[model samples]
Target: MDIKNKVALVTGGGTGIGRATSIALASRGAIVAVNYSRSKSEAEETVQWIRSEGGRAVAVQANVSLDREVRGMVATVVEQLGTVDLLVNNASITQHILLDDLEGATEEIWDELYGVNVKGMFFCARAVAPFMKSNKQGSIVNVGSIAGLTGAGSSLPYAVSKAAVHGLTKSLARALAPEISVSSVAPGAVATRWWEGREEQMNHLSPNLLLKRIAQPEDIAKMICAMLEQESMTGQILTVDSGQTL
Candidate 1:
């Protein structure tokens, strides 16, 4: 589908992949709604950048874990930017607990991780489905992780949560096919804020990676743009892992 003048909503668009995605979509002539849970300033900055580039955009605030908030966010986007033609589920949280620290992977951590990663993506997709169906055309891209495919990440719960996202991508694609295409991008060790203090770990692991380096946020963003351009691709998880899975 042509993204020009389409309205796109990106959750957690304040930083990392989401921010890059927002910019990419805007550059493609889409009216972007940049969503953020706490990074309001960052979201605003993204909006400003898009505007500076002569694109249309707005900063939206919402927590994807809450269905009510998700609903409200969709409503605001529709009201302000028009019904969403593109939805990018990018908001997620993870803890840096070691796999050996079974004690550290408590119920609270599980809930927080799942709430934002699994349930959050579902909630946002559910909220936007109606709008997309109404238009009879749309695209949904869920930001997952290579860890989901390999069952490895900063924490076990984080990996499990992203795995659930991959499952949801398939299920949603089947459920919303021929109208709203659903797909996912699973990136490996992106150089986002999530890896701040873990630089040494990533450095140590880099040599083993086939690409011998980590992925940048723009690498994942470009793949998302490519998926959105395709009309026949759905229920597919494109892994932009720089060959880490190899």
Candidate 2:
């Protein structure tokens, strides 16, 4: 699957891995729709950057947790850039509750995390399926976390949500076979805004990895583009954690 001239939609395409991926896709000649829930300025900045680099892009707004909004967003992308050929389900959110603090993992916390991290991915995938099927080919890469595999993260619900995302990726792969490919990239401790206030912790954890450093957004972004461009792989979860899980 060569990415050239494909219409790519990247949810949360304002910061971190999402931003890197939008840029990467555009650099490869894909027409990009940069989706954001609230980070309007950042999304616009990303769009401007891509345009400045001689790439085509647009900043779109949608809260992916809402199925209606996801559908509307896909429609808007089609109206503006044609049917979506690639999707990067990169939008996600998390809370900082300690894993052992079951009380802190309240119903609202569970709902909020799952809404954005798990259901959001599904909604986006569902919204775009028809277009991909119409085009006869498509690719999707869900952004998962090593925490999904390890059951450890900022919060228990967040880890659980990511695990669900991995499951969704496989199911979508099986459900949308022959015409579309679905996969996941599970990254560990990426150097993104998610670690803003936890800089000291990130610094301390870096040397513990086999690669001696935590992953940068581009590292994960590169893997995502690779997953999108490959034709033979599906229902796979590729880890770009600098060997952290090892």
Candidate 3:
């Protein structure tokens, strides 16, 4: 849990919270494996930033939804940095979708959203468990959303997917306790490219947030660092909504 010189794999590291976390951990003296699906440039940019900051890091390409790619991702990470000390399941997709906007959603949406947010998360965790067990220690942090808790906002599939993540966190926590720890961070609203072109009026309502503004990626990233190293928390989600739900 010391994190210094430890190894961590962050999915969707190309941008947003994942990128922020990669930089944070690398800056803290940990070797980070940054994962991205198509945003190669962004992933490389994150790596460059980390290296420029005198931190060790490597950018990897992988589709989190595919078990094969997820397996390969972990393998390459371990090949480069040795055993992983932390795994952050941060990859997910959420497009503004009204149920009536189309045909009440479809298999495509379900597959894509659940594939990354739910299935891919568990796949990565499954791949990492053995390594953690072998090492006698590890931490898994799943990036979720406050929308799951509120049961609204994000696409129906997305909310359901995040709920599954929380469930996975609890079951895995209980199953891995005293060994590997599993926890979740359900952010309310962290500004990122994923939100582009989605909202119009709400875009100007940042000042109306409970904390009077939306969150920066670093806010959630640093919290993930703490959870992975804290040693006293697991199986729970720490939401960073600025009191939006309070």
Candidate 4:
């Protein structure tokens, strides 16, 4: 899948891995649709940076948690940027509740997290399916987490939601085979704003990792680019965790 002139949509493209992925795709000559929920400014910033680097990009606002918004977003991207040839489902949410604090895991918290982290991915993928299937070729990469594979993360619900994302990756791969290649990139602890006040946690985990440092967004972004370029790979969860899970 050559990225040159390809149209790619990245959810949560305003910040962190999504932001990096957007830039990476643009760098490869893909016209990126940067989707943001509340990080409009940041998403625009990413587009500006891409433009500065002589790449093409646009920031589209949409809350993946809502089906209508997802549909509208896809419609806008198709109308403006043409069909979505690549999709990176990176939008997600997490709570700080501990695994043992089941009481803190209220229904509201569960629903909110699931709404974005799991259901949102499904909606975005489903919305873009027709466009990709009609084109007879596409690539979808769900941004999963090591927590999904290992049952460890910021919170139990967050981990569970990521697990659901991993499941969706496989199911979508099977459902949209040959024409669309579906895969996932599960990253370990990354040094993004999401870890703003979790220095101690990062410090504690670094020495144990094979790389002895946390992953940067670009590290994961490079892996995602590689995944998008693979023509024969599908239904695979490529973990870019610096061997932390080992």
Best by lDDT: 2
Local error of candidate 1 at 102, Å? 1.7
User: Candidate 4 residues 195-245, lDDT tens each?
Assistant: 878888888988999989899999999999999989999999989998989
Local accuracy of candidate 2 as per-residue lDDT tens digits, 1-246: 999999999999999999999999999999999999999999999999999999999999999999999999999999999889999999999999999999999999899999999999999999999999999999999999999999999999999999999999999999999999999999999999999889999999998999998899999999999999999999999989988889
Better of 1 and 2 by lDDT: 2
Q: Where's the lowest-lDDT run of ten residues in candidate 1?
A: 197-206
Candidate models: Cα lDDT each: 0.92, 0.96, 0.87, 0.94
> What residue runs in model 2 are displaced by over 4 Å at the alpha carbon?
none
When 2 and 3 are scored with TM-score, the better candidate is 2
Between candidates 1 and 4, the lDDT winner: 4
Best by TM-score: 2
Clashes of 3: 0
Provide the lDDT at 239 for model 3: 89
lDDT of 1 by residue, 1-246 (tens): 998999999999979999999999999999999999999999999999999999999998888999999999999999997799999999999998887789999999999999999999999999999999999999999999988999888899999899999999999999998899999999998888987887898788788888888888998899998898889899999989878888
TM-score of each: 0.98, 0.99, 0.95, 0.98
